[model samples]
Target: MVIYVFDGSFEGFLTAIYESYYNKEKPDKIVAMDDYVENLIDRPIFIETDEIKSDKVYAGIKNKISTNALKKVYHVFLSEVMEAPTVIYHYLRLGFKIGNKVDLNLMDDWVLRMDKINQQVASEKHRMLGLLRFQLVENDLYYAPLAPDHNIIALMANHFAQRMSDQKWMIHDTKRCIAVVYDLKEWIITPIDLPAPPVGKEEYLYQQLWKEYYQSIAIKERRNPRLQKRCMPVRYWSFLTEKK
Candidate 1:
């Protein structure tokens, strides 16, 4: 049995496929590099990700599986869960077994597990979309900082680019050490060393006006702090426009 150990990354997962194909060996199990246990495997192949290898397997998977399957796998990867790599391997294994028909619901434990994790990742991505706010910097580039539970940075980029297009914007994923930048022409996923924008007098006034508008809408008699906290937790409110 060939144990394929890959870097703990989506690209690394793809690169493993390339190695499996090039080596002409079916992998007994494909696991994250950190998850591989040295348990007297008959054969073990540790694949370090190379861009060429990554792209090769990526293209192969795209050609072999329909776009929908590729998308599902991507969503699963976004979770960044320790179990996600194993789940993805099972999904891919099933895909090889049933071809495109593997996508259908079945009384399968692995499938259900992957589906549930995917749902959680999707939900987090959507929540971050509504919660994220930007701060305009000196160069007119808008920047926002967020620490999401999942790697939703890539998933949320499309929504913001369309909603805030024509404005140069940057949404930094603090935990991941990456950011998505949307320039007038297009969006580019990049790394970050964010510098704060110069605090201009007009910017301060705008912030004050925003705060005033939020305050004006408050009704002391009807306010329920506990109920409000349930919807948007206090921990997440610090960066919100209306929250201090």
Candidate 2:
């Protein structure tokens, strides 16, 4: 009963998969960075993974398995789920074992679990895309901060890239301490530094106007805090334009 332990990162998990199949040992168990096997009886393998060479593992999936299957594999990782590395490894193992064709049917335990994880992450991303309100900072960069339950920051990139393409902006996931930056030319993930000092009058005016429009559009007499809460939960109000 060989067990494999990996850091709780997509690349780390990929390294585990590479190790899991790359070696003749055929490890019997797999788990994330923090998870520990309860009843350990066999040789244990622990891997401190690197993202660079792990691209080879990812390439194997895209090259060996169909490219479309790669999408399913990534969704499982992007899920930001507990014990996600275990689930992704299970999915990949099945993919390789099944060879030519791979079907992700909900009836299967692993498939169902991955599907549920995808839904959870996707839901959070969609909600945050609209709920997120940015602060216009010095040098005309829009900065919005959020702490999502899932790793939906990557998921939110394209949505904002398309919507705010013409503008220079940044979306900061405070929870992760990383940010998605769009500088009108292109979009890339970046690390956050500090409080982006306020941009002069123009930016402040836009946010102020947006806030005013938000307040003005609401019909006070028909306001229902309960209904609004149900629609846009209070958890996201910190950066919601209307809520603020």
Candidate 3:
């Protein structure tokens, strides 16, 4: 069996697809270099990322397939699932044949899997947008930390950058040790290892007030832990000021 290995980048995956088409060699699997494990029986072909090749593949996907398909493909990639590369490879192969209607073929295993992965990434992005909480820190910087299931820090950062364009903020994905930092002018994603800074006195007092308000507004007789947990999962409570 032949396995195509890439550098775990979107560009690299696209390059692999380009190679697969031109080489006319069907690979049994496509995986990121970091995720690949050597097996005695399998022949691994490491595909280097080529901007020209990847760009051609990308444009083909955009023109041959629908723009929506391109978005779904990107979202599925950000899911970081173990089988994502292989899934994307097969999904694109089918997409190219069927054109824009490939997503309609929900019966196909790869299509269904890709759709599900895309949905998962989209759900997390939506949830993080509302659930993300920012705390005022040193240099008047607003810092928020989270551990989302998907690699969606960039998506969330883009949203906040537009809404809070006047303020400086940072959203840290503790799970991945990366952060999206936004200055008043622009935003950027970068690797980070810093601890949560201490909340200032005013911020502490504000948090306490907010928590008190949260409790005050709750009707003890109508408390519904199950419903509350469903709306706001327990996993996110650690970072919420009121929950703290």
- Give me the candidate number with maximum lDDT: 3
Summarize candidate 2's per-residue lDDT along 5-62 as a digit string, tens digits.
Answer: 7787778878888887668887666777566655646677888797766898888888
* lDDT (C-alpha, whole model) for all candidates: 0.79, 0.76, 0.92
RMSD of each: 3.4, 3.2, 1.4
* Higher-scoring candidate on lDDT, 1 or 3: 3
Top of the candidates by TM-score: 3
Candidate 1, position 13, lDDT: 85
- Return the clash pairs for model 1, or none: none
Which is better, 1 or 3, measured by TM-score? 3
Error of 1 at 69 (Å): 1.4
**Candidate 1 vs candidate 2: which has greater lDDT?**
1
Better of 2 and 3 by TM-score: 3
State residue 115's C-alpha deviation in candidate 3, in Å: 1.1
Query: Model 2: how large is the Cα RMSD against the reference?
Result: 3.2
lDDT-based ranking: 3, 1, 2
Residues 1-244 of candidate 1 have per-residue lDDT tens digits of 7888887878998887667666777787777877767877457788888998888756755667667778888898778787687687777767766777776856788888878888989887878888897876667878788888888888988898888888898888877789988888778888887644566666678789988998999898899988988877777787787896
